[model samples]
Target chain A: MSLARVHNFAISLDGFGTGFGQSKELHFGHAGDRLHQWMFGTQSWQRTSGSRGVDNVFVRDTDVKIGAEIMGAGKWGHPGWEDDPDWKGAWGPNPPFHTPVFVLTRHQREPIEMEGGTTFHFLDTTPAEALETARKAADGKDVRIGGGATVIRAFLAAGLIDHMHLVVVPILLGRGVRLWGEDIEGIEKDYVIESTPSPSGVTHVTFTRKA
Target chain B: MSLARVHNFAISLDGFGTGFGQSKELHFGHAGDRLHQWMFGTQSWQRTSGSRGVDNVFVRDTDVKIGAEIMGAGKWGHPGWEDDPDWKGAWGPNPPFHTPVFVLTRHQREPIEMEGGTTFHFLDTTPAEALETARKAADGKDVRIGGGATVIRAFLAAGLIDHMHLVVVPILLGRGVRLWGEDIEGIEKDYVIESTPSPSGVTHVTFTRKA
Candidate 1:
């Protein structure tokens, strides 16, 4: 059985996944890269210069055994991405996700086959429907929930996530898209939560569903 | 010079200091004792039966050299506390705070002297003005900010907090009054933030002002 996993999802001290006023140019808006600065210093991000710490260990797990990816429209491109037919996503030619990536959006578009093995498949579906589509595309492998906050929160609210790895960054982004909503109370009852604070000043929190 | 400090301030993973709809019966509202279950097992709480761990270390620091305290009216009493003129604080006769504790409220009342050196002084003043009264009453000792979120947010917005110790419990109180607000975006630039996660599933976060 394949799992619906979320890895290396960074949030501010205030639980904001992305800052306010996120635009085409500024992906994280006023937050900049502050939420993910800790990962940049890891060996998985540097590839050649960074140190092999707990952060690097978690960063490397981003690509481990994950087949297809499901992300919200905001994460695939900017706000007005649907208007532009030539939107190639935030990642360049060869995206990090080498699997068949499913983009959940209201405005549907044909599958765009990018360089490398990555292909962007647009779908207008609910969290459960999208997961079913992504799971089939995954081909017996796990499906990674590539988030922009809303998508992850939806999946979480629907009780579809099996494993979630959230990194709590030490800074507070006062205004942003918050991950935890009013419907998320008692969500911990379904999962075994564990938190480990690394020396780099970020705490890695994991919620693994009890079988 | 005496500094303004905050200690043993517990918050949920979502940054809620206290849950929504707090009443006289339900002090923390929907959150119940989940936000503070980590402290209940510590030596500082159980007196004779608790363990001496990192939680106890920070818990014991709550009353270290704190001559006076400033807390919000919500922390002192329930929502409609002003109506009851004869109501003492939640913490019986001999309260935990053995100092001049100033309660920030819209309605002013005469000071109530409790047992164990805890005197509740009601004041209707701004964070700066209230701090002035507390500092004078502190008499060369540090003033601790006892909070229920609003008062702490006010002092934080005013840049009057010299030291802040926030404990992030693993639980997520989905709906409640949040500690971080829009005015606190670049507040991290003023202090050195440190995060230490204990085995008891709580992360102790400290913000020390740069000298």
Candidate 2:
């Protein structure tokens, strides 16, 4: 069976995956790119110039076989990008994700094909339904959960994730979207967790689903 | 020039220092000793026969020169211990804290002298006031912030904590008292942060105040 996976998702010491007041100018609000600076320093995100240390090892799966990508509306575009007809996405023409991207949003729109084999499909469905659609679209390959915390938290609550890689940054983003919530207590029972600390002041924690 | 420091404080992956329904039986509530199992394995807490690994390094500060400790009332006793006059702190006859320990609460009580060098003094005061009393009791030595989350969070919010050591456990407590709250945003600016992951499935994060 193809697994549901998440990779290189960053969260603060307080578990905030993204900060509050996100906008076109500040994609991560007051947090800016503080949460992702570790990933940026890795060749996985840059694909060219970066470190070859412990961080790169975790981020090395940038070219993993992901048949489909499921992301939230906030991660797709700004807060109100649905009204803007010209907003194809934050990515100029070609997004990093080269798969059938399922954008979970209440404001459903027609699928928009991007460069480099990336396509955006809007959906207004529940977590299980969305995962089912994404899995079918994945076509025997793994389905990647592209997150902004809120989306990943929902999938986690729904118990749809099989493997997740979370990079816990040392920074404290006081207020923002949390990857963990009160609704998903004892979630650790479903998976075996391992953590590796990087020299870049980040802890890479991976949770793999139990057999 | 005594510095205010915190050591070996444990919290869940969701940042809950302690779980809900804290009673006499359940000192740490639903969290029980799950958050502290790492510390329990360390020679620092055991005083003998424990692993001498990376985790032991962080927990090796049991003999640190701390002349005084300030903790929350919840840490001092159970639910309604104020009603029961015979109640001493949870540490039993001879407490672990061998110094002047101040318990913050509304109902003031006479000092309870334990078998060890520990003396419990109940006081109703603000964070600053509590620190002043602790510092005096410390008498040039360092004052440790003996916490139960709420007390530590209060000190952090009041800008009274000079150094803090937080151990992040991998468990997810769906409901509990969170150490990091929405009120104290952007707390990272005041300190220099560092994280080290141990094989015991815990990340030891230290925050030292900027000079």
Candidate 3:
């Protein structure tokens, strides 16, 4: 069975996955790259060499086999990429995700295959349906939930997420998209939660589904 | 100069200081002590003997000299506490606070002296003015900001808090009063935020005003 998983997701202290006023130039809006500094500091992101700190431990995903990914329209492009036919994705040719990436959006388009086995497939569907399609595309490996906040909240509220690893950044975004709320109250009952704080001042929290 | 400090405050993963549907019986409402389990497990609250681990390190507050406290009405009594004239406080005879406590409410009742040095003073004033009154009563000692979420946010938004120690529990209350949001956007620029994860899964986050 292919498990639905979310990895290396970062959010603000106030629960904002990204900051307000996002634009083409600002993928995370006012948030800038503040939320992902931990990942960037990791040896994995540094490639040749970097710190092997606790943050690197949670961020390292080279051992896992991810077959496919499901992301939302907000993450696929700038504000209005649908208007331009030439817009492929924010990720240039040879994107990082080398899998069949399912992009959830009302404006469905034909599949566009990028270099490095990454293909963008537009779909207008619910969380459950999207996960099903992504699972099939994932083959026998786990399906990664690539998010920008709204998409992750939807899947979490729907109880479709089997495992989740969220990094809580120290800053307070004040305004932006929230990752959790009253819609998913008591969500803790479904998962065994654990948190590990790194010396880097960020706390990495993981949620594993109950057996 | 006396500092305004917040200590041992517990909030949910989603930033809810307390739960929803609060009543006389449920101060934290749907949260039902879940957000405070970390504190209860500490040696301070446990009284006899408990884990002196990282959680206990943050929960211990006996060393500080607290002259006065300012808390919201919700922390003083239940939802309809105003209707009852005989209602003293939730903390029976000897309240844990051995100092004057200023309760923020519109009722504007007279001061009620309790057993110990604790005395409840009802004030219908702004956060700054209330802090002034509490400051005088504090007699040069630190003024602790006792909260139920709204009170804390008010002080925080007003830029009056000097130091805040918040414990982020692993659970998600889903529905309740939020501690941070758009109202306080960019507030992080004012203070230095640091987080440390405990062995018990709770993350202790502290914010210290810049020098």
Candidate 4:
């Protein structure tokens, strides 16, 4: 079975996945890159210059067995990205995700093939349908739920996530799109959670669903 | 110089100090004891039966070098506690805080002396005024900012907290009063934050103001 997973989803101390007033330029809004500075310091992020530590270990785990990805529209591009027909993803020509990436958006567009083994497939479907499509594309491998918070919350609310890796950043974003909602109350009952704080000052929280 | 500190204040993964709909019976509301289960498991909690670990280390740190405590009215008593003039406190006749405790409330009442060294002093004052009173009572010792979330937010907003020890529990209390607010957007710039995750599935986050 292809597992639905979320890897290295960073949130502020106040549980905001991304800061308020997200724009085409400032993807994280006022938060900037504060939430992900820890990951960027890891060897897996820089690939050549960063150090090998607990952060690198977790960062390296992100791409392992991730054959397909389902990401929110906000993550795929900036606001009103659907309106732009010539929109290539934020990852330039060769995106980091070398898989069939399913972008969840209301306005569906034709699949766009990129430099790497990546293809952007836009879908206007429900979480279950999207997961099903991503699972089929995964082809016996795991399906990664790439997020900007909303999509992850949707999948989590639907009880579709098998494994979740959330990095709790120490800084407080104050106001933004929060990860946890009322629908996710008592969600811990379904998963066994573990927390590991790295020397880099971020806590890695993993939630694995019960067998 | 005495510092204003917050110790062992447990917040959910969603950054809620206490859950929504707080009442006399349900002090932490929907959160119940989920956020505090880590502290309850520590050696400092049971005193005789609990294990000595990271949780205990932080738990023990809670009472060290603290002469006075400044807590919110919510922390001192339940909602509508003011109506009952005879109401002593939730900690029974003998409270845990062995210091002159100042409770921030709109309705000021006469001070109540408990069996322990704790004396509840009701004060209708601002954060600065309350801190001034607590600091005076502290007598060169640190004044702990004991919280139920609102009081902590007020102190943080006022930039009165010198050192804060926040425990990030694994559970997500989907709805509650949050610790951080719009007034504290760039508050992280003032504090040097440190995170340490314990085996008990909780991360102890400490914030020390930059001098």
Candidate 5:
């Protein structure tokens, strides 16, 4: 439906997606890597990242549905390096998500080349603008909000998202950056719960938006 | 030996500790159940919750560790009831935490007993006051900052914690609640990476208070 759906925006249970005052060294901070356990074992990610394996139906279905992805600059890790053109896409080698990605940033930079069909488009655009661009590029597929928290919250606070898939891994990053801030106010969310447990004990839940 | 340990608090990667509006029904929210996957499989939780004959290390450790606990009125999802002599602890049949818990609420209530050693104490004390009471009641043990977000944040901001174990679940709950607010400023955290994976693919990271 061309709606902006913030799919799989991983944040810390501590209300942070990334730690505060983020630098390149602290992308997602401390135990931030723990959040991606679900993706690593998934066929969608494995195939894209170049691995040969039998696929789990649930993981496969969930992975291929994503069409476009967006993230804030912090999620992207760096924004002021446009002049140097030294920025690299967060994923190394062949990245997952063989789709277009829109990165929200302040400084304008050239598009980043990535493996697979993924391309990192740095946009100084507002949330609405990025959503619109992502929607157009998504080609009827869902627009995934890959985030560092503030970016996703912006879209969510504006009520622009349609669905969210939250995978709750069981690790805690006590401190670093927090994605959710109390400064945000005036919002309501209604979700239908769809939960499934992988053999590894990672619970994958899909929250379809209601109103 | 009291130090402000990083990772003492945990949050759902979706940025909510529970559902909105602080309603009792909203205690865990739709996906809130997934947040406690670690403790659910813990031996301590299993034994206390009456899930015996289940051989699992994670479950056993988490259960016995929280031998006693506490909460605030706001976290209990009920107020005024705390003033009653019959105020009971949350969880039915057997509560989630099998230990004795002292809750810090403005309302004073009699200690309501449960099937297990778990009891609810509604205290009108402040953060320090509650900690003093909790420490004594903890049987010279670790006092868990069983949270409703605000309560945990209060203790954290007050520098009253020793060690924090944070499990970063792998999902983003785009909207609902936040852990820290803009009003919470100038706080610092340091963490060491103690990352291990649970059977459920949930990473268990332990953070000690850095001197």
Candidate 6:
């Protein structure tokens, strides 16, 4: 069985998943984008876009080492913009996520073709369908659940998630849309302290899921 | 002249103000709604809507305790349904913020009108303008910098805030957005802590701005 893990997901030191008010131009707002600076500075993010550069060792090794990528409807595709005649991918033609991707959405849309092997398919069914699709697509690789909290909670509640790696940045988006909320209940997690360092004053932590 | 405290805004445990997304229907998402549950259960939020059922001691002391309210354009208005126009305010006919509200936005929109003396003025001019407007409206009362993080940061960076209250919730968004980022540098804050316990397994902490 393929294991489900959310890797390189950054949380605030106060435990916020996303910042607030996601839009077409700026998804996840300013605070959300800040969480990505660590990864964005990495060669992984640049290499996927056909750029050449290298970040620090930390960014290269830990920030961008996901085996497979999974995301919810919000992160996968834009609603109204999907049909935009000029609607190219949100990222420049070459996006950071180069591997196979699974999108969790309620609507069915045609698979999108982009540079590299990236193919975006909309999953209109339940989490089970998304998981199955991701499992087959992952080819025995660890499936990384990319998210906006609701989707992550769905996987956690289903007990489908195996490990969680959360990078806690030191900022607090005092107010905005928020990452997780009252929706999560029954899921209990014992976080195994993987790493803790204050480089750039942000602490990165990883947890292993109990088998 | 009143002192501007930067860290006095209240934050939810999970780190959301009104919640995520653009759809007003989902505005303040459940966690956002739940964040205010305490205020709702109290006289502060309920009495504004003219519901006087008597609540706890905190409510008894702070009837309309909040001095002023601040927020972002994202939370002020949303795209209404096809038949209904988008010009509609976020809270429909009446919004909870009965006091003057400073809305952080780059777009130039006219001030909004609603019942209970709430007027949503778009602050494209500057953070100082918003603060000045809110202060004038506040009439020597404390100002509540309601936020989406960016707005809050603007106030914090400008040294325009006086106090902060953060309510740490237990859920994590995995990835949505963040609050503090690189732009914030060389600011000092001194606060007095006030802790309150709740049934939701969340702790509400109030920080008084100390000069």
How many clashing pairs does model 3 include? 2
Task: Write out the backbone clash pairs for model 4.
Answer: none
DockQ, candidate 6, comes to 0.07
Docking class of 1: medium
Clashing pairs in model 2, backbone N/Cα/C closer than 3 A: none
Candidate 3 lDDT over A47-86, as tens digits, reads: 8888898888777763388899999899999789889999
Error of 3 at B115 (Å): 0.8
Which 10-residue span in candidate 6 chain B carries the lowest summed lDDT? B4-13
Each prediction's TM-score versus the true structure = 0.98, 0.96, 0.96, 0.96, 0.53, 0.48
Distance (Å) between predicted and true CA of A145, model 6?
A: 1.1
Please compute the TM-score of chain B alone for each predicted structure, in the order given: 0.98, 0.96, 0.97, 0.97, 0.71, 0.71
Global Cα RMSD, each model: 1.0, 1.6, 1.5, 1.5, 8.8, 13.3
What CAPRI grade goes to candidate 2?
medium
Q: Identify the runs in model 3 with alpha carbons over 4 angstroms from their true place.
A: none
Model 1 residue-pair collision total: 0
Q: Write one digit per residue (lDDT tens) for candidate 4, span A51-102.
A: 7998888888988998999999999888878788898889999999999999
Give the distance in Å from residue A123's predicted Cα in candidate 3 to where it truly belongs.
Answer: 1.4
- The TM-score obtained by model 6 is 0.48
Task: List candidate 2 segments past 4 Å from native.
Answer: A45-48
In model 6, the runs with Cα more than 4 Å from the true position are A30-32, A40-67, A83-88, A186-195, B1-211
Model 2: per-residue lDDT, tens digit, B130-175? 9999999999999999898999999998998999999999999988
Give me the displacement of residue B143 in model 5, in angstroms.
10
Interface RMSD of 5: 9.1
lDDT of 3 by residue, B98-163 (tens): 999999999979899999899999999999999999999999999999997899999988999999
Better of 3 and 4 by lDDT: 4
Error of 3 at B29 (Å): 0.9
Task: Calculate each model's fnat, 2 decimals.
Answer: 0.69, 0.89, 0.92, 0.80, 0.05, 0.11
